[model samples]
Target: MPRLLLVDDEPSQLKALQRTLRGLCPDLHMDLALGGEEALTHLRARAHDAILADLRMPGMDGLTLLGQAARWQPLAVPMLLTGVADFATAQRALNETGIFRYLTKPWEPELLRAHVCAALAEFQHRVTQQTQAAAWQAEQGVLSPQELERLRLEREEPGLTHVEWADDGAVLMPALDAHLPSMPR
Candidate 1:
């Protein structure tokens, strides 16, 4: 099950969000925090797949909390929800903290659910890739500089490269051409 953390300073707003999320996504494990500090506490206790925090708060605004989250839980997806539709703040959140999404107050339940699901899926993909890379490193000892560069390129531009794994654990990159040599028959 995907775990999520919701942060809002207002008690009523936080409770309402929790209620709506529970009704919309009963299977999701959700936690509510009254403020950024409380949210940080929850984040420290366990790993959450996604975090949605209101932009404005009394202490440690959403952006600040998100920056901390970025360092602490780099894999977790962070989202900003605020009543104020400030583009500057949104840009800062995206550029500095890498927020997954910026949602305004009074968000549509369905849309919110969709975004959260997408973020969770992305977080899962990142976690899976990290685990696979770690396992490969352990099995193959240390990777060569060229191999590491290839892996990085594959991740950055997945469509630009086609990778094949040979029986002896060799990575093969074939040119994108119809007349390319075929495997021996």
Candidate 2:
């Protein structure tokens, strides 16, 4: 069962989420946070598989909390729960927060559960890819000095570095550090 952290400023919202998700995802262990501060506290205390947060809140808005939380646990999937119907807010949620999903208010349990399932599935897929890639690298040859340098550069500017490394037909996301065998000096 995946652990889920729910953060919202409103008690009513918290109650709503609890009631909505109770029978929907019985297998999930839900942790409650009244605000961003409390949410960060819980996030540090335990490792939750996913987080659901309200967009509009006092003291550390959802975007900032999500960004900071990403640094804390790069793998913790985030989903934003908000009633804001504005397109700009949705765009910001995607670009700034990197949210897995922006769930509108009056959520259907099934839909929320579906997003949870999808988020977990995506995380699992990435973990699997990283593990497999690591094993493959271990079984293969070492990275040359030039390749190592390329990686170092990629760590700096991922987008441009990826293009620089694209000729080798290897591409990766920012999170996973792919291993390349050491090239002969």
Candidate 3:
């Protein structure tokens, strides 16, 4: 099941945001936090696919929360929502916190839903790719330096290695065919 963490100081705002996205994600396990500290506690306990936080909070701001969240759960997609639109803060959120999206207050419901869905999809893809790589590595233990580099590159930009699989559970190497002479047509 996909998990989500929502953080806001205002209870009403948290409820409203939760209500808006309740019907959007299927079997969504959504968690809410009253403040950044509570959100961090949740992060330490479990992993979330996405995190949406209010920019203005009592102790820890959204940017700070997300920055710490990234350290705890690097794969979770972070988003910031704030009524105040400050360019400097937005820039810091993007550069330092690595937020996926920055939303202003009174946002359109449709847009918010779309952004959340996109973030979830991206998170799922990352998890799937990581699993695939781990499986591949386990099958072929003690990979060489070059092969390790390829794996790293593939993780950074998926499909970079052009990996193919055969029906018999073997890796296909189509490029090798060009170097050998054909026996029969």
Candidate 4:
């Protein structure tokens, strides 16, 4: 299940956010924090797919919290929900924190829900892309002789070290040649 963390100094605001989300997404798992410290504690305990924080908290503003959240959960989508509509703060949040969305106070429930859904989708996409890239890298890279031998042994039987190498640091697998028809010597 996708998880979300919502941080706000006001308990009522947190409740409203949770209510809006629950109405939109019944299956979403949400964790609420009253402050940045509480939010960090929740982050350390479990992984969340998205984080939405208030911009002006008593201590540890949303930008700072989101920046730290990024360090802890690099893949988590960070979002800012602030009453202040300062352009400089928005720009800083985008550039420094890499927030997926910046929403102002008195947010529309439907739009907020849509943004959360989009954030969750973005998180899933990032994870899928990372997995695919890693898999492609593994397939394209040359495996060392020891790794090849291990794979061969695991596939067939133990004590089967069929990996061969030339003196010039090139891999020469004898098994591959054995599969080919005999050529004129």
Tens digit per residue, CA lDDT, model 3, 1-185 = 88899999999999999988988977998899988888876776667899999999999999999988876566689999999999998998899988999999888889999999999998988778876876687578856667777656644543445656899989986454442334676
lDDT of 4 by residue, 1-185 (tens): 78899999999999999988995565789999988988877876677889999999998989999998886677789999999888999999999998999999899988998999999999889778755655565577755555654543432331133345799989875455432334688
Q: Clashes in model 1: which pairs?
A: none
lDDT: worst 10-residue window of model 2: 174-183
Sequence-dependent TM-score of model 4 = 0.75
Every candidate's lDDT: 0.80, 0.74, 0.83, 0.82
Report the Cα lDDT for candidate 1. 0.80
| C-alpha-based local distance difference test score of model 2 | 0.74
Query: What TM-score would you give candidate 1 relative to the actual structure?
Result: 0.72
**Which candidate gets the maximum lDDT versus the true structure?**
3
Residues 80-146 of candidate 1 have per-residue lDDT tens digits of 9999988888888889998989999898988887888889898889878875885688578777766
- What candidate 3 gets wrong by more than 4 Å, as runs, is 136-185
Off by over 4 Å in 4: 142-185
Residue 35, model 4: Cα distance from true site in angstroms: 0.7
* Tens-digit lDDT track of model 2 for 1-185: 66788999999899888777775544778889888888877766666678899989999888888887776566678899887768898898899868898988878878887887788777667556655665565557565556655544533332233332356677535323222322479
Ranking by TM-score: 4, 3, 1, 2
- TM-score of each prediction: 0.72, 0.70, 0.73, 0.75
Query: Best TM-score goes to which candidate?
Result: 4
